[model samples]
Target chain A: MRTDAAPSLAAPWRKRRTTHYRRAEAITGVLMASPWIIGFLVFVVGPMIYSLYLSMTRWDLFTPPRWIGLENYQQLLFNDPTFFQSLKITTIYAFVGVPLQVALGLVLATLLNQKIRFLSFFRSVYYLPSVIGGISVAIMFRWIFGTQFGLINSALRVIGIEGPSWLGDPNWVIVSFILMSLWGSGSSMLINLGALQNIPTELYEAADVDGAGTLAKFFRITIPMMTPVIFFNMVIGIIHALQEFVLPFVMTGGGPADASLFLVLYLYRNAFQFFQMGYASAIAWLLFFYILVLTLLIVRSSRAWVYYEGAIRGR
Target chain B: MTTLPANRSFNQSSGQLKQFLIYAVLITGAVVVAIPFAWTLSTSLKTPQQVFTFPPVWIPDPIAWWNYPEALSSQPFGRWFLNSLVIVLVSTFGTVASCSMVAFAFARLRWPGRDLCFLILLGTMMLPDQVTIIPTFILFRELGWVNTFLPLIVPAFFARNAFYVFLLRQFFMTIPLEMDDAARLDGASHFQVYLHIILPMSKPALAVAALMFAQFKWNEFLGPLIFLNRSELYTVALGLRTFVGQEYGTDWHLMMAANIVFMIPLILIFFFAQKYFIQGVVISGVKG
Candidate 1:
């Protein structure tokens, strides 16, 4: 991950004083990067330690802290039904939503890469919703998914099919979320488009001469080449989905029997709304460990499927 | 690709048919993307009765351009717009300046443990803000920053976003190292080189970072939702959320109208600086 500037010591005389001046340069580097270093220490590292401390105690805001070690974790892990509910909700969202979005993105990218007309236009329109995300989009979707008068329901009516109140139904809230997510699938589509450009035409030509059909070439060559980028998108997608907050928070408010109660939304509720700061902190640490373990496992398993062009060539 | 050896005419015909089929599918997908926004625009112009009717009114019989004014005037949206503007501008500027400086250090300057530090920085990119949300909320509350914009804006100056720094570093690395060496030889200090040389070359990357940062903060929900409790201090995003609630979900016309108005600036930015926008997404993807 660290790519340093090359050691371009042009002047021979400077080489001798390199040790002394190099230390000087290091000091300058630290100085230049002091903002981030300082920021890290304060915002990230400091708060992380505080979060761990707070997780073990019972301290609601406007009250003095009471020493209650392991209580919050025990309550969250062992007793709380909603904690398990939210975890299941979050896991289901991530597992289902990540692949669908990544696949949608790749499919969109594949089609758009075919030297199509209005290429940028397609990409832009598809990507527009993601940029305009949050409360505005939530409001728009609220109208679009309204119980009796929604756009989707109207369209469904036209086709002689009755549409459920997309956001109103507990059984359909996650499906509603997954549908809303696809509107913003352009982000990874654009990523895959960029990755697809890097795949040389010669590889396709070689496959063509071997009498590979379009589907065959896609499976054998195109997919294998795109797996690294796909994996990248999956990691980001899964993480983002696992921590999904704004849409569900604003749109569903984790309502309709907490069917859409996402983990972070539950955490936010505990911290801010319910004033269970200690419990919320415990939830935070649980999610942190959960994501860390999931990420590590995915990365470890990636060795079997993720193909690096450079690594493959080296072998 | 060059033409295959056999059935050249048949290949050409199928190719055309294949392209036609692809367009058929793509346009259908594009329609799916367009429908919600299109519906928003359409609904914004409809009368309140028109919005809730079965076999919904596709377009308003009479255009209700007054809804835009009504939406803007009915709420404290005017003030909310100013708050959002202030937040986005401050967040964007802070992000561009801080991330670029830190990126210069990571990319151009040689230091012991620089790589390790950079990795630590990248590690933060994946660390969910949720993990630290509670403690940070408390920290900000302790600072008396809860009702203010400080919680949202102050962190930007402190390099809160690791992705921006990583992005700018990727761009900074592409600038040849000799320029830094050349400046160093002329007795230009690292700060001088960063400010005078590296920054000048990094305008595009910085602009991309700024745009993405602006969009991200403009759409930000959790930070402001958690920190800013007062309706008077609410940004437009928060305003829109409350706007939906105030009517108890009855006023779709004004709500959609306001949503469109809020979307206009970002849509305009998309049309104007799409190259940078696309570049931002591509760089974030391809690099990391």
Candidate 2:
């Protein structure tokens, strides 16, 4: 992670006759980054340390924290069915939503990458949903999926089909969320577009010469080359999906029978709404560990799939 | 070699077909994404009677420009707008200054534990913010910073945005080594080099960082919801939530109006800095 600039700069500084200049460089660097360091120590690191301590204590907002060792974690593991339910929901959501989004995004990006008219206009239109605030999107989805007088239902009625109450039904809430999420797939699409453009045209031409059809060329040439970007999007998508709160919070309130009760939503309820800070902190730590382990797994497995042209060349 | 010409004709026809398929798929995807936004714009301009009508109108019959002003005056929207503006401005400035500095350090300074620090920074990205939310809330409460803008604004100063720092570090690392060497030979200190040489060269990155921070802070609902308690201190996002209640009689037109108004600044900024935004994404991807 230490860039080449650092050592080269340091080597020259070490040979300098004046020590004042070196000290000044160090001082300035620290000064420039002080906000982040200070912020990290106070906000991020401090809270992280405190969360560990809080996990062992029962602390409401008004009352001084009362120490209760192992109770929160014990209750979460053994006693609470809601925690288990939330975990199940979140796992399903992450697995289902993340892959779908990534795949849909890649497909959309590939389609858009062709030499098409009004390319920028289409790109902007596709990206529109991403800029709309999450709450707004959720609200918009609420109207779209409304049981009575909804646009979706009306459209269904036009086709002589009955549209189920999407947000209202426990079985459909998660699906509704997943469908709503597709509107903002443009961010991942843009990233995929970048990866697609980086691919050499010669590869496609070479495939053409070899009589590789469109589908074959896409799978053999485009997909393998796009694996790294796909992996990147997948990891980020999982992380984002796992932490999904705003949409569910505004839309379903974790829903009719706790069907859409996401892990983070449950954590927020425990901490803010219910004032069980200790219990919430425990949930938070569990989530942190879950993400850490998952990311580590992805990173470890990346070598199997993620192909870097440069690394291949070096090899 | 005799079959090459026939193969060429076959390939050309297939390529044209493939192109046609691409256009078809892209147009459908674009429409799917655009419809919701179009619906919102149409809904916001509709009169209350027009909104709940049967066979819901795709466009309002008579445009209700009054809905915008009505939404503005519905709640403490003016105050909310000011609050959002203040927080976003402060946060963006803090993020840019802090992230750039940290990025510069990671890119240029050969300090002990720099690698460890950078790794830790990347590792933090994987850590769910939800895990930190409660502890951070408790910390804020302990410092009596809750129910104030301090909780939202203060963190920006501390390179709290590890993603931006990581991004800028990548950009800074790409700066030619000779530029720094030239600066050093000209009796320019590292600080001067960062300011005069690196800063100017990395304007696109800096602008990108600033724009992202602005969009993030402007649209932020959770942080403001958690920290700022009073109605007077509500951000535009927080205020918009007040439109919906547990009751069935929610004001659809007004809510849509507020949502549209809240989106204005973001849309304006987005259109203005789109070039830089695209550049930022490209650079981030390349670095990745």
The TM-scores, one per candidate, come to 0.96, 0.94
Candidate 2 lDDT tens digits, A32-79: 666666776777788888899899899886889899998999999999
Clashing pairs in 1: none
TM-score of 2: 0.94
Off by over 4 Å in 2: A1-28, A313-315, B1-11, B246-248
Q: Across residues B35-102, which tens digit of lDDT does each residue of candidate 1 receive?
A: 88889999899888777788887779889889999999998888999999999999889988999999
Model 2 reproduced share of reference interface contacts = 0.52
* lDDT accuracy of residue A277 in candidate 1: 87
TM-score of predicted chain B, candidate 1? 0.95
Candidate 1 CAPRI grade:
medium
Residue A14 CA displacement from its true place in model 2, Å: 7.6
Model 2: lDDT of residue B46: 93
